[model samples]
Target chain A: MIELKNVTKQYPGQPHPAVDSLTLTVPEGEICVLVGPSGCGKSTTLRMINRMIEPSAGSITINGQSVMNNDPDHLRMGIGYVIQQIGLLPHRTIAENIAIVPRLYKWPKEKIVRRVDELLVMMGLDPEKTRSKYPSQLSGGQMQRVGVARAMAVDPPIMLMDEPFGAVDPIARTHLQDEFLRLQKEIRKTIVFVTHDINEAIKMGDKIAIFGEGKLVQFGTPEEVLTNPANEFVENFIGYDRIVKKLFLYQVQEAYRPAVCRLRPEEIGNALSKMLAEKAEVAFVLNEADKPCGYLTREELEQEETARDADGLQKLAARRSKAFVQTTTPLPDALSVMLEYDAEYVGVLKNGLLEGVMSFKDIRRHVYRREGE
Target chain B: MKMSWERFQIALFEKAPEAVLTHLLIVVITVALAILISVPLGVLLTRPRYRKFGVVALNILNILNAIPGMAVIALALPILGLGIKPAVVALLFQSLLPIVRNTIAGLLEVSADVKEAAAGMGMNQRQILLEVEMPLAMPIILSGIRTSTVYVVSVGTLAALIGAGGLGNMIIGGLALFMPEYLIVGAGLGAIMSIFFDRALSYLEYKITPPGVRAN
Candidate 1:
């Protein structure tokens, strides 16, 4: 655990402290994202944890030991740090960059080499192809991945990441964020993430600490902060789209309703009867093993008057790739899949088996019910 | 013309071979000493507390640089009392400005992000300076050394004025005796040496520059 007690950082001439007397505790194996507008001392607080920026007053302890007791270099070596610019040493190849800490710790040569290749693979880069390439040779996304890989080279238990994905284009940023999230699930390192983008905070933070000026205005789980903002500033910071943003925090499985009308590809008459009796808009067509094969809309079913036709509902079903969403997909993504395919609903699948289906109506109802409460 | 060529060969191979050797020796020693003194002095000036002192030191060196090489040698003559010693000292002072100024400039040109990353990654101040800052600043610093080397070689000719044996002796002696061959041999060899040293250092600069930062 990382704990700060009444930490304050006051510049010599500045009237207000850059970071006021603030205290925060980050539990083991959790990500605490520090977020606010520019110059709110979010970065200051992060630097203080590693002793890069010493606080004027108060104590900081990592893993229950006072940070002051350790040498700054020794302390820093034990913590991973990544920044916005992805500061990989331009002169060094990707492998050398990743080997920095491990080499610093005086690991055996083979061990360092092994770790470098391991981290490259972990960051989704092909080690043999990338190990010898310099930072300048890589794209912005690749450089950012290498930056993260370098930070994790020594497997430091705590990581301090300051807007690590801020420099990439939106498409690459999303890709990097997904890869990092997947990597984080496996590593489970205690991380202190700093970002100003609220959506990013909601997406990656296990708990978000909202800062205003030099003080933390609110610190809570994304659900708590979104559902019950501490004050007007936080509410304003979260913006008017908080309701919709909350949907990103929920998975498709959480809001999906069991399909009322599901039918095998051959059972066209039964499919039509179920759609009619249930007044459903779409009927999911299943294959022999009960996996979602395609879907048929009531409009298409009505046009096909002959239910006993050889092709039956199978021919009428639209096998759109966008119609499929996994159970683990966030509701916002599921909604986007619906919009992308121009479909009324999306099938939620687990291991190729149809668990249920979700529509905009289901997400809206779920979000609205939470809002009402 | 044939007589001048015969005289030039005799002057270069027999009469003044020692002058040529001494001239090369003086240039090498002066440049080596200038590099040893100025590179560290340049690095020292870049430190935050010493930065102002560095500016003041550079200004003093700039004044020294502005002075004519002959005048600097003349000034050194009275204090050190002549020969290769005072001449070497004057040339050393003359070369200081380029190496010092270029070292400071090269170090300063390193991006703030690179330094922060070095520190954040647990590199101490010395490691950051050596492994990160120095390697990045090398191309610029080597350029400075090249300039200093050329200056030292050209100025070493002036050491002959204070009874220092160099190619300058031939030029001075040839003018007095009206021997055009002596002048050509001295001036010709000096120019060739300057070009040779400059090219060598330029090659060094190219080789030491990090591949990622090498100009296209």
Candidate 2:
């Protein structure tokens, strides 16, 4: 855990403090995002934790010891730092860059090499191809990966990131964010991430600290901040589209209605009867193992001349081409899939078993109810 | 008198071998002194506090460059009067501008991102300078050194004016006596020496450049 108590930073000639009596605590193995507009001291607060910018007053501790007592270099080595422009050493090979902290600590040559290769593999790059290449030789996204790999070289428990994904294009930025999120799931380092993009904070942060004019205005989980903003500043900063943004915080299973009126493949007459009795437009068709097969709709049942026809139900039932979303998939993504496929309903599967179903109406109702609350 | 290839060969290989040695020695010492003085001075000039001083110092060196080589030798003659000593000092001064200027330029040109990275990774000030800044600045520094090497070799010929021995002695004698063989021997050997050193340093520059930074 990293904790800052009443931290303040004032530049020599500036009229006002850059960061003022800021206090924050990042729990072990959780990401705390520091977010605000430009000149809000978000970057200043991050730099102080690593002693890149020394605080004018206040105490910063990692785990339990005050950082002021530790040597700056020693403190920094144990805390991984990444910046907006990834600063990979151009003169060094990728392997050498990743091995910097290890070499500084004088790890065995074989061990450093092993660690470097392991990190390369973990970052999803081909180790053999990338080990010898230099920073300039790699693409921007690859360089950013190498930057993160280098920071993780020592496996420092605390990682300080200052808009690390800000330099990449939108598509590459999203890829990097996803890759880092996956990496963090396994490593679970205490991370203090700084970003101006509120949406990124929502996506990546377990807790968000909102800064305004060098003072932290509010700090809470993404849902708490979005649903119950601290004040007018946060509400405006989160913007008018916050309702839609809140959807990203929810998963498909969280709001999905469990599958009902399900029928076996051979129960065509029962499927039609269930649809009529439930006053539902469609009934789910399930195979013998109880997995979703397709949907038998009222329109399809009426279009068919008779339920007893040999291939009647099979021919009338819509193909099982409706998109399948995992239960863990976020609602916004699930919603997009619905729109993209022109789907009225999507199957939500958990471990290959149809746990529930989601439709546009259900999503709208859930979102409206949440907003009302 | 007509030029004779045999006499020229004799002058180059046997008769004036010491003069050739003296020419090579002068070029070596002068270039070495230039490197020793200018490289550190260049690095110091790059420091933020000293940057303004660097501009003033470079301006003075630029003024010195504008002066003719013979005039510098003549100016040195009054203070240190004669022989290889005065000529060496003059050539050393003459080579300073390129080496010092280029060194400062090279160090300044290193990307700020690379330096910030080195610091962020926990490298101390000295380590960042020696390990990161120096290696990145090397190719440009080497190019500067190459320029100085060529200048030193060609300019060493002027040493003969101060009663210093080199191929210049033969050229001066050949001109006085109207002997084309002596002029051909001296000019030919000097040209070869300059080209040889320039090419060798150019190759060194290519070798020392970091592979990642290579334009290719």
Candidate 3:
């Protein structure tokens, strides 16, 4: 556990402290994301944990031991740090970059080599291909991965990431975030993540600590911060779209309702009866493997001029656009696919098998229930 | 007085090799001493505590550099009194500026981000200098050494005025006797030495540069 009690950082000449007397505790194996607008002291708080920026007042302790007690170099070596500008040494090859902390610890040569390769693989890079390559040779996304790999070299118990994904393009940022979330499940280091984007905070943070003008305004789980913002600043910071952003926290499975009318492509004759029985405006079609291939609207089925396949069954329109989400996909992402395909509901799949559907109505119902609560 | 091939052969064969060796000695000793003094001074001046002194020290070096080589040798003659040692001391003064300036420039040119990363990785100040700063700054620093070396070789010919007995002795002897052969041998060898050292150090500079940094 990392705890800061009444910690403050005041620059020598500046009137306002960069970080005011603030207290926060991050429990073991949890990610505490520090978030705010620019110059709000989120980065200052992170640097203080590693003593890169010393706190002017109060104490910072990790696992009940004061951060100030140890030699600063020794203290920093035991903690992992990553930054917005992925700082890999230009002089070192990828393997050497990852080996820095381990070499500092004087690990055996064989052990260091093994650890370097292990980290590269863990970070999804091919060791043989990337080990000899220099930082300049790697793309931005690759360099960021190597930066994280280097930080994790010694398996430090605490890692501080200051907008680790902020430098990547949006598509790569999403991939990295998801990859890290998966990696965190197994590593479970106490982490203090800093980010400006609320959606990122909600997605990656086990708990979000909101800062404003060097003061920590609120610290709670994403659910708490979104549902019950502390004040006007938080409400505005969380934005008018807080209701929709909250959906990112929930998986498609949570809001899933079994699709009322499901038909195999060969079972198209029963589509009208199935929709009538369940009062569904649309009927989902599944293939022999039970994967959702398409859907049929009641208007299309009711039309006499509707096209049919060679088997005398009504043709499935919008066939196999992959308009489905895995059961584990976030509701916001699932909602995006719904919007993209212009559909009322998105089919939820488990291992390529159709499980159910989550509709716009289900999301609205979920939001209404939370708003009432 | 005629430019005779026989006299040229005599000058080249009889006196050329010894004068060339002595000239080489003056330049090599002067450049070596300059490097030893300048590199450490440069590193020290760049350190936070001593950084304020850097501007003062560099200005002094720049003034020393501005003094002509013959005048520096002439000034050294009174204090050290006529020898290869006095000549080397004079040339050493002339050589210090380039190495010192380049070393300071090289160390400063190491990007702030790279140094921050080094410190963030828990490298102490010493390690950052040895592991990161030095390697990255190497090519620039070596080019300074090259510049200093070539300047020293060209200037060592003036050492003969103080009886230092380098190729300058040959040139002075040829001037008094009006022999074109002696002048050609002395000046030619000096020019060739300057070119050799320049090319050699350039290769060294290229070789020592870290491969990743070479991409830039």
Per-residue lDDT tens digits of candidate 2, residues B5-43? 887787768746787899999998899999999999999
CAPRI grade, predicted model 3: medium
The segments of candidate 2 whose C-alpha lies over 4 angstroms from its true place after superposition are: A276-281, A288-290, A297-316, A368-373
Name the better of 2 and 3 by DockQ.
Answer: 2
- Residue B101's lDDT in candidate 2: 93
Q: Of the candidates numbered 2 and 3, which has the greater TM-score value? A: 3
What DockQ does every candidate get?
0.77, 0.74, 0.72
The regions of model 3 sitting more than 4 angstroms off are A264-267, A278-282, A297-313, A316-321
User: What would the per-residue lDDT of candidate 1 be over residues A1-373, giving only the tens digit for each residue?
Assistant: 9999999999999999999999999999999999999999999999999999998999999989999999999899999999998878888888888888888899999999988888888889999999999888899999999999988988999999999999999999999999888888989999999999999999999999999999999999998899999999999999998888898889988888876578765676567678888888877877777877778778766776775463755655645534989989988888888888888888888888878878788888888777776
lDDT, each prediction: 0.88, 0.87, 0.89
Which pairs of residues collide in candidate 3? none
Q: Using alpha carbons, what is the TM-score of model 1? A: 0.95
Reference-based lDDT, residue A153, model 2: 94
* Candidate number 2, chain A TM-score: 0.91
| Each candidate's fnat | 0.56, 0.65, 0.62
lDDT of 2 by residue, A1-373 (tens): 9899999999999999999999999999999999999999999999888888899999999998999998888888888888888888788899999998898888999999999999999998999999999988998889888999999999999999999999888999999999899889999999999999999999999999999999999999998899899999999999999889999989887788885667677776566677888877766767779877666657767676666452656554445545668989989989888887666777788898777778888889988888777
